[model samples]
Target: MTDGVEPGTVRPGGRTARVREAVLRAAEDALTEQGFTGLDLADVARRAQVGKTTVYRRWGTVTGLVADLLQDMAEQSAPRTETGSLLGDLTANARLVQRTLTDPRQGALFKALIAAATGDVKTAAALHRFYDIRVREWAPCVRQAVERGEVPEGTDPHDVIRAVSAPLYYHLLISGGRLDEPTADRAAEAAAMAARAGVFVRVGGKQA
Candidate 1:
């Protein structure tokens, strides 16, 4: 692994990993600077300073490239930070979500991916996987809180984690509003309040 990355991850070693990062960075840059239609894998290969064959071999199509990009994002995402309090943990989670969704480069990249997903099943799957990984990562925090009795028993950790970012993303992507730190804090507070009120309690079989 490259310095701090855990083993068996895509880090700064191995030819494939190097090539993948180069291509992903190139793709991210291109997608941010240019629109989705303007994203040329050939250009990405050229910018990455790798052969077109390598790029093609790695990601066969634009959809495939986008999938790999989302996968890389999940892999490179920081692990959840535990602050021993649900509020603190949620604030951290909200801040991370706000920062990622508002970052110029990453935000525009996701916009491109979102547009791509409208026409590409593979891209949609990749986006789902990205959320799944994030949800799983943050769910443990809720579970820990439940175990500590900070929240009631049978609270759905996954739902709690999703609640922290769902409104943030909606405002970011749908409402076309600013995703600022205050908004993050608001989201965190709202989720914390809802959790305290048992809105996230595990229901019968379906909603949990």
Candidate 2:
């Protein structure tokens, strides 16, 4: 079925956005309370106080719902702030990443999502899309820095952005290291150092 806006809900510049926000929030809450395997559209509809038909009509399946939810989150998440310097931008970005990684609810939700993605191709694709959006959102800071001569001429902004969060994600998903503010700062500094040394610079038009 072709799912569009909910019936009786306005679109573009009005309550439609708010209704979508509420639905997404309910979906996140459902995901937090119950992992991917336990996620239920009925529960989400009940929590959101929206129509079940609307939920199902809008998202054909659980994977589609989760994918839409992740996309909405990426859109709502804060964008990179320009502080006129690479250090400032990287620090701010690192702090944001750390805060999200350390948040109990979000962290647990992510762990569950990772587990689900491990077994489900659809979920894995959705997860990849989420990271892609996040990476694209923050990559511009590194590009701006390059233009300002703060980094090498050939720095890969996307790689630089990904590098900033790689260590933090590794700690959370692998090493079990603490993701504290200090660690966040260290990651930013490390990424900065690497960029300065041309490590982030692309070679042979290929990203490493």
Candidate 3:
């Protein structure tokens, strides 16, 4: 079943693209409103105004549909911000994560997906891939920082990038703390400070 356009890409086509958009949007709505337990293929088709046959034939199962949704999200994620400084770049990333996790629709959708992934291996893999894509998107900025001599040599770019958002996600998923803009800025500050101190340098690479 292939109702989705494809993972890791946005293919160029009209009707197929429209169908993909509608289905993904409907899936987002359903997941936000009712969580994964309420994700039914027929209901999703109805919500999308596409045929039940189309949804069933394309997705085959809820797990597959959810996986496709994560892939679509990764593809549609915002482009990296270039600020010419590690702190600035990390601040941008943290702010993006903060905004996304605090928005009502998006926040709920993510909660549902995370919850679904906790019990489903396929969903978990898809979620991991989604983060991997996002991490890759921002890792370049860390590499640039290294070139600028901001961080130590052999710093794990991905680790530093992930650190910028780690606290925000911790608040979202663990601490139940507020995810405000200040919190985001602080997350960036902490990550940047640690990074500048060589806290994220590869174990065998370099140290402060």
Per-residue lDDT of candidate 2, residues 136-167 (tens digit): 98888898989989899889998888888999
Q: Which ten residues in a row have the lowest lDDT in candidate 2?
A: 4-13
Q: Answer with 2 or 3, whichever has the higher TM-score.
A: 3
Note each model's CA RMSD in angstroms. Answer: 5.1, 3.3, 2.9
Residue 121's C-alpha lDDT in candidate 3? 91
Model 3: residues with Cα > 4 Å off, grouped in runs: 1-12, 203-208
The digit string of per-residue lDDT tens for model 1 on 1-208 reads 2566322233335667778888989999998888678888899999999999877766768877777778788978999999999989999999998998888788888788888777778778888998899899899999888888888888888888899999997997799987899999999999988997888887775453
- What global local distance difference test value does model 2 have? 0.82
Off by over 4 Å in 2: 1-16
- Model 3 clash number: 0
* Model 1 RMSD, rounded to 1 decimal: 5.1
- Candidates, ranked, lDDT: 3, 1, 2
Q: Which pairs clash in model 1?
A: none
Best by TM-score: 3
TM-scores vs. true structure, each candidate = 0.89, 0.88, 0.92
